[model samples]
Target chain A: MAKVLMKGNEAIGEAAIRAGCRYFFGYPITPQSELPEYMSLHLPKAGGVFLQAESEIAAINMVYGASGSGARVMTGSSTPGIALKQEGISYIAGAQLPCVIVNMMRGGPGLGSIQPAQSDYNQSTRGGGGGDYRLLAYAPASVQEMVDYVQLAFDKADEYRNPVLVVGDGVIGQMMEPVEFRATAASDLPPKDWATTGTGGKRPPNIINSLYLDAEELERHNIHLAEKYNRIKENEQRWESVGLEGAELVIVAYGTTARIAKSAMENLNRQGKKIGLLRLITLWPFPEKGFAELDEATKDLLVVEMSMGQMVDDVRIVNEGKRGVHFVGRSGGVIPSTALVEEKILEILERSE
Target chain B: MVNERTILAGFGGQGVMLMGQLLTQAGMIEGKEVSWLPSYGPEMRGGTANCGVIVQTEPISSPVVEGNATSEIMMNTPSLDKFEKDLVPGGKLLINSSLISKKASRDDVEAYYIPSSDIANELGDTRIANMVMLGAFVELTGAVEPESIFQALESRLGLARAHLMDINKQAFARGAACVKEQRN
Candidate 1:
């Protein structure tokens, strides 16, 4: 297919349609409002349902109901809106329903700035609601990745029967770029025999519920979820490494921050500084495998983010104090400049020297 | 590595976003990597608006022009005041002389002043000032062909607004001529 220019949010919506997602339930929010708007316009024409629910809470529950009935469903919102859907998300996760959730993050402790941010890293990677469940989260950096990941997210969601998240900051949601929707070979997914698709009196009814009243049964269910999470950790970790061979420092970042760090790395590398980048594509799986394979010459690890320090904790956990871990971040809608990043790296390199 | 990072800034209705989009579209038409990021949210309602556009042969590392802008196109005085310092040393500055009165304070960069609104007015449409600025950028940098921009505009405007194509082309030509005259 020919490349077409599209905004990230609209591209995600189109990709979902191409992935055979037939139901969308979402509320409008800045930065990501375009996604739901795009769906409302085009999904109906594709013989799908696009619904604007009353609240974020209502929207997610609608996704829950739709997914329970064997439909590929999705819901999207910005940070605070995503917070509102957490309880419903936990329920969906516990019920083992396959759905895709998109969170185009904005700055927030509560109703903060409307600009782009990565503050929701912990909330997304670690569960936001009360649950022992885990979500398969993909943090895409570009519009093209957003398109490709949204499709992959659907397939992954269905394969695991768990909700998958395609999380990008406001920039990825708002930016426009050329994207080609490459033809994706359909995955050999397991049949939805577990869905509540009206038994027609020929088979037993399939019940979709997360509630477990029996203490031992709930423990068993928790253990089962833990095993699924372990499997995901083993097989689904995804990351990208650049210039890792004999690097003096490795910068860990994701989403838009990773892109900025890449520019900074390129600039510094041109000036004979040995800097590498490890860009995490899956936030939940945490890409621990990338950390384990870090170049032996890398003496320092700098974690960059839009939030003050969330993903850094994960990096620290994975690094195990082998290298000096550093952090540089900006919050409240301020995107870290390439100059600032370059300065930070120079400072770290000087300190190590 | 023909990387051109441009910041286009103006008031809400000045069509700065459209200018960035057209530049990016033209870049894409030429098979170059490009990205366009707009200043969105409440600021876009009635206040100042801006966008960063990157066009290059290599993959764009960042879509932001916050600190590494190679050029700036300012449609108003405040925009010039705001973004003049963001440009890298030896960068290009294009100002809309019709709306901005002050000269660019920076001496390290190449500055071009075009009364874009006046040129657009002369060309029979005040709204084409952004196109004029875009044309000047294209002529100065040759980042993308003028013909590619025309193709981009035609596809963007579609068949419904096909009649406006000639005027937009004229505005673009006037913009290019303004730059040529200044250089001469």
Candidate 2:
């Protein structure tokens, strides 16, 4: 495969196509408008279904309807737009349908800014919609990773019969990178025995609906999802560590901040600084074990984010006050520079010394 | 392994970000680790936009470049004003003379102001201006091989855009000539 320069959002759309995702429904939003735009152009050429739904509510519901038919369906939106679709997402989970959702997160509690931000961490992981449901969330920091995770998200969703979320920020959505894409197999997916493709000689007609109206049945469904979640924690935990040997300070971050933190560590290492990076690739099943393992040897721990201490709260919980934990963040869409990280690291070092 | 960092900045439509991407892709084709990060959110479409690209011979430890990159490309007067002091001392600077009237401030830096937009228009397309600047940078700094850059561009152009590859190839040659003429 040859490297092709592709925008992050467009790459997400193309990767879905290559992954045999034939149904797409989305509305327009900033920092991710290119996603729907690209889908509009390529989906038809690939003989796939593309719909410009009337609203995000309609878009997500359309995804639910398509995925019920056993097709790989997807929809993308930004933070605010995703919030509007949460109601439908809850329904999708209640039905236990396989689908893919992408949130190109932007800053804010309410229309804050279009800048990249990690403020949606808690909302994304803790079930933004309703009910006891957990969405497998994959956080990608770069354009190439964005493409990789889109394909992975579909595969995971189908495997678990649950929706998987690809959570990225505007930075990951808007940037460009050289990517070599693998073509998706159109017929390689497992047959959807549960799809409502009409019943002829089948044992029984398959029906997929969220309304159970039975307490015991709903409890069983919730327990089933919980079991799947536990299995995911054991098998799907993904993270990366750089320069962990003899490290004095450990920096924990995900998405764009993680990329910057890695750069700062390299620069610091050149200047004789003992620093390492623990980058979370799966933000939902937060790599709690990675940070919990840092005992007395790790002098300082820093959680870098593009929000007002959203993921930092998780880092602190995992640390359990065993070591000094600090946070460095920038809100409302401003990405912190490497110099700011260096200053923060140096400050921690000074305090430790 | 040397990590070649660059920050290209200009007004919204000056093609500064495109030049950054072109260089990054060229580096990637050469089997180098590369990343292209552009300004997003509020500054992307309307306000000033910039892109940071880091290319290294080894696995890239970090994708972000702190302070200033080893090279800087400015396309407008405002961009020169904003990024003049950010260039690494004695680093390479390429300006679009047709758009950027003011030159970089640091004398320690090697600066060249080419009429990239004018040359591109003469070559029959204004969009190729970024490619011209890309070519000039390769010739002036030898940061990347000129042939590799063209091949990278052609591959990235894809089947949908194979017709425009000739224009890009020509634009690269013109920019390279512009740099050689100055060197002589």
Candidate 3:
């Protein structure tokens, strides 16, 4: 394949378009502005709609409207902007719409800096929007994965009839790389009988709404969503582990941090350090089994991240705190140096002895 | 496996970002893994605009350039002052001698002086100074084929600037000739 070189943000836009996503409604934000810009130029040319809404709040609702009408819809934003779209995201999830939201996360607690940060892990995996619903989140590390995951995310979103989040950091959004656009048509997408596409007077019109007047009725809806969530957890927990076979320590990371962690793991391994990496591609499913299957020789686990140890909590729970689990991270757009990560692993090994 | 972590830095109008993009695209043409990351925010508006370009044979992790660069192209004195310390020992440094007055003092690196702006000026367009440096850097590092860079440049400029195409090509050739002449 004659691969094309593209920036991560631009590649994501092209991937979404290739995946049959015709509708893109987004407002501009740092590190992810290229995504909306690309869509604006291409979506209309592809016979799709691209609307730059007045704000992130307005843009996500536009996604809801388009998704309800049976368009493969998407929107993107950085950290603070994504935060603003929470209400609309909740509404989309409540209505059970299949849409993709790309959050190229930046530093945040308030209106944080425009630099990359993974502090949104708790928000993305737990709940960025208010609800009992979970977004099927894909944490891609490389620009190629950033492009590849869109088609998969859209497919998963449609299959589950729910919202999916491609949660990458600023680096994944802004970095440029060579990526092959292996065309993945959201092919085999099931019929959207549930969509609010206008009925041609042959049958009852499909209505998309989340409100239930009766508590029991709402309970039933909640149970249905729960069942699907549990099924996804059981069937769709995706992860990658390297060098866990005979290692004394394993590093748990995802997104850009996972990429750095792999480099550190390899560099240390070359120097005879026993280290491994467990990368979570699907952050929402939280791959508990990947943790359980850790090599027996693994005596300790280190959770390395770009945030101040957000993912470490999950590492502690799954590992049962039975093994020494250490956390090393930096927030506010700082990526931990690979050398520093290697040093931490060596330090952990030394301390345990 | 070959790896080149580079920083092409200069004034905002020096086309440093575009040069980074061209190199990244050239690397892709050769079927190598590559990454280009621009220095964003306030620094972009100031004279010191820079972009990190990484070309490797393996999947790139971190994307951050970290400390020292394996190869560097500095177009102005500020860029030279800022990034000279970050150039790795035994790495290649291409200085735009037209704008930069000081020569690199480090003995650990291979520093090549190219009057890229002067060469582009001779071609009747100083805008191609970035391309001029690109020509010399690629020749010295074997980063990519000269034809690949020409292909990248044409595509990058598109038809909007078709009239300037001849001069740009001339600028690239002159820069490469300058380096070859120096070696001779």
Query: Chain B TM-score of model 3, please?
Result: 0.94
List the candidates' TM-scores in order: 0.99, 0.91, 0.95
Candidate 3 C-alpha lDDT tens digits along B53-93: 98888877667776658989999999888888888889899
Residue-wise C-alpha lDDT for candidate 1, range A172-273, written one tens digit per residue: 999999999998896899999999999999999999999999989999999999999999999999999999999999999999999999999999999999
The residue-by-residue lDDT of candidate 3 on A1-353, one tens digit each, is 67887888999999999888999999999979999999999999999988889999999999999999888999999888999988888888889999999999988889888888899998898877877888999998888988889889989999998999998888888888778888575477789998887788978989889788899999999999999999999988999988889989999999988988888998888899889999999998999989888988899999998888998888888988678989898889877888789889999999988
Question: TM-score for chain A of every candidate model?
Answer: 0.99, 0.96, 0.98
Instruction: Rank candidates by lDDT, best first.
Output: 1, 3, 2
User: Candidates sorted by DockQ, descending order?
Assistant: 1, 3, 2
Q: Cα lDDT of all candidates, in order? A: 0.94, 0.84, 0.88
For candidate 1, list the clashing residue pairs, or say none.
Answer: none
Candidate 1 local Cα displacement, residue A209, angstroms: 0.4
Instruction: For candidate 2, write residues B9-63 as lDDT tens digits.
Output: 8778767776787787788778787778887644645478888888777765456
Off by over 4 Å in 1: none
Maximum-DockQ candidate: 1
**lDDT: worst 10-residue window of model 1 chain A:** A312-321
Calculate model 1's interface RMSD in Å.
0.6
Scored by TM-score, the top model is 1
The residue-level lDDT of candidate 2 at A292 comes to 56
